[model samples]
Target: MGLGDFADKAKDAVNSDKGEEVSDNAFDKGSDKLNDATGGKFEDQIDKGKDAADDHVGNE
Candidate 1:
């Protein structure tokens, strides 16, 4: 992996102790806000993008 990817993995490890539920909730809240702001026009894409991000960030 590149240096940035390594750094991100390290950060994820450190924050993993916070527990998965916390991470999931935070992402859900952010997604909700984005959907609300956009009037649900991009709801599906936003949800999918959020899921992908959460997966990458070690939330799932």
Candidate 2:
């Protein structure tokens, strides 16, 4: 819904260490925010966003 919400979700997800499970949800939710913030310019990069979020959470 927002950055704060996303962060909260991510925190829990990352802490759980279930990288693959949370990856799609985090990517879809966060990527929507990113796309909205960037005025649709980031629509072409959902995969990158997903991968980045996956890597970040996976590392935790």
Best by TM-score: 1
> What's the TM-score of each model vs. the native?
0.65, 0.43
Question: Clashing residue pairs in candidate 2, if any?
Answer: none
TM-score attained by model 1: 0.65
lDDT of 1 by residue, 1-60 (tens): 899999888777646857466777888999999999999999999999998877766533
TM-score of 2: 0.43
Q: Which stretches of candidate 1 lie over 4 Å from their true place?
A: 1-17
Please report, as a residue range, the 10-residue window in candidate 1 with the lowest summed lDDT: 13-22
How many pairs of residues collide in model 2? Answer: 0
Over 1-60, each residue of candidate 2 has an lDDT whose tens digit, in order, gives 999999988777666747556665767788888888889876878758677766766435
In the order shown, what is each candidate's alpha-carbon RMSD?
4.4, 8.3
Give the clash count for each candidate. 0, 0
Clashing pairs in 1: none
